[model samples]
Target chain A: MIHPSAKIGKNVVLGQSVVIEENAEIGDDAEIGHHVIIKKDTKIGNRVKVGDLSVLGKTTSKNKKMARKPGAALTPLVIEDDVRIGCNTVLYRNLLLKQGAFVGDLSSIREKVTVGEDSIIGRNVIVETNTVIGSRVTVQTGCYVTADMIIEDDVFLGPCVSTSNDKYMGEGNYPYQGPIIKKGAKVGNNATLLPGITIGEKAIIGAGATVTKDVEAGKTAVGNPARVIK
Target chain B: MIHPSAKIGKNVVLGQSVVIEENAEIGDDAEIGHHVIIKKDTKIGNRVKVGDLSVLGKTTSKNKKMARKPGAALTPLVIEDDVRIGCNTVLYRNLLLKQGAFVGDLSSIREKVTVGEDSIIGRNVIVETNTVIGSRVTVQTGCYVTADMIIEDDVFLGPCVSTSNDKYMGEGNYPYQGPIIKKGAKVGNNATLLPGITIGEKAIIGAGATVTKDVEAGKTAVGNPARVIK
Candidate 1:
């Protein structure tokens, strides 16, 4: 059901059973797959390709026990030109995807997040709320980007990397703050980054390492409670 | 689009845009959500609840680089009574889910897999092909259960646990063999289980541990290349 107030641009292709809510705007040459849902007031730019069953501009579901509280009203989600969204992906409201951003299958991007241009979020990745990922970043399959995190430009995160934002695991004493991965930092597969740490510029974290502290610039860290290797 | 050959039992609730292919069977009191696709010859038992955008009895997608090859024709998927499947989940063909099993949202279960009674597969979990998850097992959120694995009854895997089946990734030289987690074993959050290891009964793997070898029965393992603790 396309709402009468929704604006569809020239050459837009909508598949079967697509729901475009009120005031949603789809730019020229946009391709929306079957069963896609675009919520109210979402703005999708030209040449965006949304795969089947993708849900865009969805509202957040929060419980009372959560430390962070959302505001009364959130801004609409914005998608720039040449963005590619895979099947069964869920992108929440108040998010921004710059040009050429790619979200893979079964991924979830929460609200208040911004993904810069040419960024790649691989399959089954979970990017939590209030995170900022810079351009040319590559987050591989099954990685978890925690809430309130900052990933700078040219960062590479391998598959199954787990980032934590809470040190106390819901005790609510410590404030939630995920790691700050600086430019050109590379985290290997199955690595764990503890809360509130900083991965310095061009640093490398080895596979299966558990990082508990800040890593120095241009250094390599490996093992549990990761230590710098010469 | 319900096919003419599909068999729907009494009091089954189907949502909008649901697609049931030929020879598919839905038992009594089953609740199928919107945009759910049940492929040909799939069988869903009584009181099953399938959430929106789910795909059941899907075929496997294999490239030439994959080590294992699927058979010419696979059998239908079977879900027993009272099973619950969450939104955006995908279950491949030739699989079986016993009574009262729960598959959380955005999960993916590959073909030739068997999940025993009352097993809980949490959100964004991936169970690869040829895996056998026994009765009452609990695999927590964002876990990766590798192919050819054997997880026995009552095993508890915490959040973000990663398992591997290949010694050399994508080499195709080594035989794929994932970890064999024995009955009632408990693996903590962010743990990494290396290929072909055996986790003995009631063993405990500490959080953020990288397990390299077999863990003894009723023991506790911690740290990278995890050693037995007192």
Candidate 2:
């Protein structure tokens, strides 16, 4: 049941049992699939396609103190024009998925995150809060994009990539921080990026590597500790 | 809508908008959550709990030729007594989740799989086709249990554990055979196990390790190619 306050534009196709809450706005030509839930205050742009069972504008109670801020619902979810969200994806509040961005099935994009235009967040991926992904970035299936990370333009992350946000692990509820994946960098499948490191421009991290430190520009890093091979 | 052929036992509590397909049976005192879909030939045992949006008896088209085998529906999805299926989970047909088994949210278990009694399949975990998990096993969040794998009793797999099939890396589709995690083995977070390798009884695989070879019984392995540390 769509609330009386929802502003659904022309040619919007809502599948079986799509729920649009109060104050939600769906742009023209948007297709929301079966069992989808658009929470209160979500703003979906034109030509957007949200697949079956996707949920947008999920609450950020896990953020603890950040969620208790005054007027939390005032900041709505912004899914820009031509974005494509796959089946069973979940998006939290205050995220901006820019033009032509594609999020794959079963992925989770948490709050305060920005998915750049033409970027691909593939199937089963997780982009935590406070992260920024640049244009045309391809984070493949099952990759875990840690919080507070910056993935620059033209980056390619292969399947099952893992990233960490804390140095001493989560012993102290420490602030999140992670590696900066520079422009045109390529991280191979199943690579693990340690906290606070940086992958230089055009660098390549081989598959199954555990990156311990920073990699220089135009270098190829492989194996555990991930030293530059070239 | 409950199909005419579906047998819903007394005291079964189905939440709003639950769909029970043809030949599906929900045993006594089973609780099904809202928007849950139980497909054809599914059998939910007594006291079973299925969370919201979960789908049971999904087709095994991804199993390729195996899906066309005779009597596919005859080996119906069986959730034994006191089983728990978490939210957004997808369980394929011909799988048997034994009594007291608990599957966490967003997990996917494919066809012909048998999860033994009291096993825990954690959140976001994917257990591929034809795998057998023994009793009291704990496969934590984000663990990928590949096809044709065997995880024996008392095995513990930590978060983000990745297991691969095909030693030649899908060169021939390779028949999909992965490691056998023996009894009482413990695999730490983000560890990758190579194809056909056996994790011996009481063995330990450390975090971020890329295991190329098998670890002997009572051994502790760490690092890339995962040599014995203890």
Candidate 3:
């Protein structure tokens, strides 16, 4: 079911029962699988392979807390060229995926998150709201990138890695503080980065380690509360 | 692109470009949306609304080290009568959704997960393999129920809640050590339930609480390591 207002470019192969909502723009040579939903005001890039049961442009966070009363600004989601989005992936509104980014199956990328060019997000990765992942990064399966973290370029995040942003976890507080991961860092599988900490460039965080403080550049850290290993 | 071997019952309303693979069975009065994919060995129940881009009978966790090998067992997905599956939802092989079960938009239910009768799985919820959810349960938005968890009847799971079964998570390590959530339990938003912990019957888990131990029945748990509040 394609709306009359939906802008579909030439040679776009749409499989059975696809729904293209109003004002959605699909670029040329994009392959959309069956039963996919492209919601309103969404724009899909060229040569993109949108797998089955995938939903794009749904706004996940629309509450009274996010409302600016009447004349507030609303952001749009932009997916750049040659991206491959796997089956059942959900890309909410106000997000941007740069060129050649790959999101594996069953991933949930929340609002305002940006995956930079050529980054690979593996299966079941939950990237929370407003997190920025830089270019050529590899976030492995089951990683949880919590809100407001900055993951710089050339970082490698292993499976089930988790990061938090709030120090007191916003307990009884409204605005929460976030964390950052600098460029060229590597976080191993199941590693936990506590809130408000930063990982410097070229640092290595071992598997299942918990980082409670800032990690220096080119160092390796491990264990709970993470002492510097190198 | 419905295969000739597919069995479509009477009064089925097939939307534009829907694909029903070989041996797939569509029950009476099922409404399939455009571009939906009903892969092989899938059984759709009567009066079901399979939304656009929704995929049924796709692959599950057989490729993972924690799961059974591929071709060790293969079973069809059985979606019972009166189910309303929203757009971009994926039901992999061996899944069973009982009558009146409603899976909201962008949800992914992996292999062998059973949603009991009248259960409502909210938007973007992820149910990993082999989980058994009881009747009339409400799993809210953005929650992740990892593999092999038992959620009893009438449980209420809030947004972004997570349950872990694996204490030591890795390849060849089956992370299914988490305790069951007894009947009528209510887990609030963004709560984390660590491995090997049980939430007793009628227990209330507070928002953003990190639960590391067992919660007694009919109690309210809050804070990190989740002490009983009431």
Candidate 4:
């Protein structure tokens, strides 16, 4: 059932059993495939395409305790014009995707995250809450982005790159801090980053490296406890 | 559509557009989410909760020769009572989950596997074929379990733990033999286990450690090419 409060624009096509919740707005020339769920207060701009079984604007609070934190209302999601969301992706509440952004299949983007214009999130990528991804960034498949991350413009993260937040593994009081990938930097596949480290501009991290510290600008880091080289 | 020959018990809650194939049986008080697919001859027990978009009873055969070995009919999946299966998890055929087992969100359990009673398989975990997990095993999120593993009781694997059965990485004639994790052992997050190694009883593998050899019983192993530290 399409709710009465939903505002669907002209030339929009919705496939079989798609659910558009109350107060959701879809702009002109949008295509929503089968079994997609557009939750309440979501706004989709013109010429957007959402693939099959993708869910938009679901509420995410990390855990039950955080969800029950006082004064937490459901946040709104915004997707600008010319965006493409692939199959089975889940974008949580407070997500903002600028124009020309692309999100691939089976990805999960958490709450309060923004994908700047023309960014690309590949298949099976998981971006947690409060992460800011800047324009023209590319995060490849199977990469895990922890919460509170900052990926600046034109950065490239290879497939299966895993980042962590807590070094102590809940044993002690360790503040959660995600990695910082600066502009034009590139991280190779299967590289692991420890908490709170900074990858400087144009830095390169080799495959299978375990980065335990910050990588300086214009340098290359490789091997375990990654050191600067080349 | 639920198949006519399928047996659904009392007080079962099925969401919109769930598909239950022929001869599938769902026990009492089970909650099946939207777009979930339960294939033929699969048996689910009482009070089970299957989250949205999860697919049950598909078949997987990783070995090319075994998959080409003909005369294999569709295998069956058996889930005992009071189990909780999270969102988007996929369980292949020839699988068995004991009573009170909990499977977290987005996990993929391949064929011919048995998870013991009261065990917890965390989110995004991939347990390949022919794996046997003992009771009360805790495998945390994003861990990758290779084919043909034996995990004993009371074993705790932290998040992002990776295990492999083929050390040559599909290059040499490395015979497939997965790691043997003994009883009461603990493996910290991001630890990589090489092929065929035995982690002894009560052994502790530290976080980010790479296990390249057998770990002695009750010892603590840490670092790449993991050596006994304590």
Candidate 5:
């Protein structure tokens, strides 16, 4: 059932028993699976295949400890053209999946996470809060990307890769810093990149490597306190 | 439409245009979302809420390198009674969500994971393969539990927390040992628990802490190479 305030483009195929909430927008030739929930202020682009049981744009207040006020401005989730969001994937508010980005099944993109154009997020990837993923990046299955990390363009994150963002973690308020991964870098499977470390462009982080320092461009690093191997 | 191969119990109230796939078993009074894909051999228990765009027992075999064989036997997903699975949550093959377990919206439980009874897994939590989460545990929002982790009962994992399973993290094969979090432990927000460590019972890991060694019971730990403060 499309709500009266919902905007539907021409030739949009909504499967039987679909529920579109108020102020949602579905573009032309979009196929919405059965029982999907497109909540308020969400925009679905043309020709997108939104699989069943997926919920988009469910708004909630940010963590009270991180916010200036109890209630803040609510932003909508925007999905650009030619994006194929797989089954059971959820995109919350303030998420923008640029054109041709493919989020595999069961992937979750948190708020303020911008997946650049043509990036591929594999299945079951948990992209934590405020991480910016660059265009044409490939994050394989089951990667845990912690908050405030920046993955630049053409980066390859292997399956089950891990990244951290805080160096001296404490309970009370602490200074916040962001980690940067430069373009064309490759982080191997199950690798652990520590907080505030930068991986230069085209650097290769070996599988299972624990990187604690910045790797120069085109170098290879590995180990517990990862040292440059090449 | 319940397939003939599907076994549904009495008093089940399926909403309009619900689709149950082959060999799926639904218990009494269960409410399945419309267009939800309860795939083959899934067992959903009584009074469960399988929300919209949510897919149960949908396993992807593309990651064949991680399996023992190229393609091993496909096991069923079992959900016990009173499980409240929210929108777009996905349980892959051989997952067992024990009685009274609550999986928040957009979470993903990968293959062979067991979520213990009455455990509350918050929004966007991703439990990777073979992780065993104990009863009454609470994994808060955006936490990533890596493979083969043993989280005991009454454990509290905060937002954006992560655990590693591999030490060297080499490719093609995962070679690192898993970590164990003992009962009544609390891992704080944005914390990182390295592999092969054991967090003792009643220990409190501070927010943004990076735990490296085995923590003693009732201690509070924090820092880059986390040390016990109390």
Candidate 6:
């Protein structure tokens, strides 16, 4: 069901059973796949492609058990020109995907997040709320980018990387702060970055490493407790 | 669309937009949620509860880049009595979920896998092809259980754990064999178990540990390369 208030531009192709809510806008040459759901106030720019079963501008659920409460006054979700979203992906309200960004299948991007231009979020990746990802970044499959994280331009995060925001695992009173991955840094597969650490520019973290502290710029860190090897 | 050959027993409740393919069998008192797809020849036992947007008996995809090729002669997926499947989960063909098993939201269980009775496969978890998980096992959220793995009864795996089956990461000709997690074992959060290792019964693996070798029964292992600490 396409709402009467929804705006669809010329030459746009919509598949079977697609739902466009009130005030949602789809630009020219955009293609929406089967069973895709676009919530109210979503803005999709020109030449955008959304795969089957994707949900855009979804609202976050708040429960009593949740440690972090989501913001109430979220704005409309914005997807700039040439953005591509794969099947079964979920993008929350107040999120912004810059031009030419690609989000692969089964991913979940939370609210207030900004993904810069030309970035790639691979399959099954989870980008939590309040994170900012810069341009030309590549986050591979099955990774967890915690809330309040900062990933600069040209950063490459390998598959299954785990980043933590809470040091006390919901037991302590400390503030939640995820890692800061600087520009051009590369994190290897299955690596774990503890809370509040900063990976300097062009630094390398080896596979299966458990990083406990800040890494120096242009250095390589390996093994548990991740000391600089170079 | 429910196929003419499909059999829905007494007291079955099917939600809107559901698709039940040819020869599918749904037993008595079964409750199927919205937008669910039950493929051909799939068998759902008595009192089973399936949540929204789930796909059962899905076929596997094979490509040239894939290291492991799926079996050709796959059979129908079978879900035993009282099994509960959460929202957006996908279960492949040739799979079996025994009585009372719970599969959480957004999880993917591949073909030829068997999950025994009363086990819990948590949210966003990935259980690759050909893995057998025994009864009462707890695999927490965001963990990756690689292909060809064996997990015994009462095992506990924490969130974001990673288990690998390929030692060479698709480069070498070595046979793929994931870790064997024995009965009552406990693996903590963000732990990485390397290929082919055996975690013995009642063993405890610490958080963020990189396990390179086998862990003995009744022991505790921690840190990178995971030495026995107890």
Those runs of model 4 whose alpha carbons end farther than 4 Å from true positions after fitting are A59-73, A170-173, B27-29, B45-47, B61-64, B67-75, B80-87, B98-106, B116-123, B134-141, B153-160, B167-175, B183-190, B201-209, B217-224
The superposed Cα distance between candidate 4 and the true structure at residue B46, in angstroms, equals: 4.5
Kindly list the per-residue Cα lDDT of model 5 for residues A91-205, writing each as its tens digit. 7888898887878777778787899988888777778767899988888766878878899998888666778766776443544445688998888655688788899998888
Q: Each candidate's chain B TM-score?
A: 0.98, 0.94, 0.94, 0.95, 0.93, 0.98
Residue by residue across A32-151, what tens digits does model 3's lDDT show? Answer: 876678998888899887877678887665576652233234466678778888787888888899888888778879777899988888667888876889988887666888877889
C-alpha positional error of residue B169 in candidate 3 after TM-score superposition, expressed in Å: 4.1
Error of 4 at B41 (Å): 3.1
Clash pairs (backbone) in predicted model 1: none
Name model 3 segments beyond 4 Å from true: A1-50, A53-85, A88-102, A106-196, A199-230, B61-71, B169-175
lDDT of 3: 0.80
- Write candidate 6's Cα lDDT for A1-230 as tens digits: 99999999999999657899999999999988657899999999999988667899998888798887555789999999988886678999999999988886688899989999888886689999999999988886688899989999988886698899999999859888999999989887698899999999999887798899999889999897788987
**Minimal lDDT window, size 10, model 1 chain A:** A59-68
Q: Which lDDT tens digits does candidate 4 get at residues B1-230?
A: 98999999999999677899999999999988777899999999998888667899986545663422333675799988888886678998889999888886678998778999888886678998888999988876678998879999978886678999987876657778899999989886678999999999989987667999999889998778888989
> Per-residue alpha-carbon lDDT of model 2 for B43-86, expressed as tens digits?
99999999998878865431111212544453889999999999
lDDT of 2 by residue, A111-194 (tens): 888988888886689988789999888776688999889999988886688999888874656666888999988886688899
Docking class of 4: incorrect
Clashes of 4: 0
Q: Write the per-residue lDDT of candidate 5 for residues B1-230, one digit (tens) a residue.
A: 67899999888877556677789999999988755678789999999887765778866433212333434776899999999988767778789999999998888887878999999999887777878999999999877787778999999988977676665432336565567999999988877677789999999999866677899999999865578897
The 10 consecutive residues of candidate 3 chain A with the worst lDDT sum are: A65-74
Which ten contiguous residues of candidate 1 chain B have the minimum total lDDT?
A: B63-72
lDDT of 6 at B68: 57
Q: Report the backbone clash tally of model 1.
A: 0
TM-score of 2: 0.71
